[model samples]
Target: MARVKKKIRQEQLIEKVKNKPFLTDEELAKQLDVSVQTIRLDRLELGIPELRGRIRKMAENAQNKVKAIQSNEVVGELIDLELGHSGISLLKITEDMVFGKTQIAKGHFMFSQADSLAMAIVDAPMAVTGVANVKYKVPVHVGEKLIAKAEIVKVRGNKYFIWVKTHNETQEVFRAKFIVVSWGEK
Candidate 1:
């Protein structure tokens, strides 16, 4: 990683954004060995929007085909959805989501995201997490974007077996197997 120097880093930042627009300011700062403020300044000078802006723009352009749950009820911004099959969502870790000292995000947030994604993919009026076998593969820090992908493995009566994996880019951070029950099912 090149230490981003004054004036020189702007060009590099532009290239970086072009290659990976999903990178947050904190991530860019880490890659360039600069402060987050410096990255933000460089991004601003380069005429690049923040990560949230990029995500929102992408989300708007990419239509969600099937929405089993209310959009607001989803744990993260639903990027794609195919009812009764699979779905994808993205969540950005923020200050409130992490521990004050550790800077590591709370496990519940990850679980909630995965669980909600799993429930949202089910073809039902209402879905609830019945039991979850969860695993945390890595410590997720604040400012990281977690992408949760959920797929239904099988359906046994009213219980749906779902698998969710949350990742930070290519690295797996969390995974869960959930047994979800639809309220419509008896």
Candidate 2:
């Protein structure tokens, strides 16, 4: 069999995202007709962190609420909470929620949504990320609303471990465990 041509380079993918009004790994993958993982790998090789990560970094640097709020890209509202320890966020996944071909929104999107809520509960000025492990259970289609409930599972020293469960239309669809480090004047 003859040899096949190589795919596009990482730089090319970055350029594509930079040119698009709304850049996402999934959208990029769909446009390129490649797998989401492929796009992730390309981003990694090019030293481009995930969108959520970038947003977190920006939030950390902001000096005021306006700048900080601008860092949030997820769409949702805080329904219930218990300040300074744990809380829950409710969100609806619409057609616009889709980042790529995946129906359940990007992993980073969920992570960010949960992270922001966790931060709010802690009432911290800035938080640093430590670790996160997420499991996708079902596909979240367009028009399906989801509720992501997160709570502080454990706190050791300055590290806070948060557990998040996502429900879609009365069904559990995703779950995640995150470790966050908060730095603020006490």
Candidate 3:
């Protein structure tokens, strides 16, 4: 690959991360057709931190807004929340989340993140997940950050139909529709 000018490479890197902060250095290197070391140096020069750091930073900003469940009990960090409407969260897949042989994340982690986000979006005192229809679109690996976005699709009486879709930078990893029973509906 012809060498991308340092300035152009930095600009592209910034834009890439702007679009998806969860991208790893290796992924960025592959996307930009540059060496990983070059990518690292470019990130450093551009005042960008490593992938995990970036994820933590993004999650830190929104983690405190969680209401339905205690922040620690939720599977992921609650980054954005608008009760009775929509919300977003972040989950970082770790070694413990993956199977030993395949290195693919266990399914429960994704479900937990989605389910919690679904419950969090209900604007009631008590929210319970009555039924979940979920699908795993792709296998996730360790060190990947998942951004889960949840929207309240419908509300009938005390029941909220919520949709959650989790994705990495390039593709969807998990999607689910949750029927949540909000006990304290006005």
Best model per lDDT: 3
Better candidate by TM-score, 1 or 2: 1
Which of candidates 2 and 3 is the stronger one according to lDDT?
Answer: 3
Question: lDDT (CA) for every model shown?
Answer: 0.83, 0.64, 0.85
lDDT per residue for candidate 2 within 91-182, as digits (tens), equals 76666667765665665556667767656555455676688888888867777767777788788877888888888765888888878787
lDDT of candidate model 2 versus the reference:
0.64
The alpha-carbon lDDT assigned to residue 28 of candidate 3 equals: 97
Tens-place lDDT digits, model 3, residues 63-179: 565556566766788766666788888899989899999999999999999998888777777778999999999999998989999999999988899999999977898999999
TM-score of candidate 2 on Cα atoms, chains taken together:
0.56
Q: How big is the RMSD of model 3?
A: 5.5
Rate residue 7 of model 1 by lDDT: 60
TM-score of each: 0.66, 0.56, 0.67
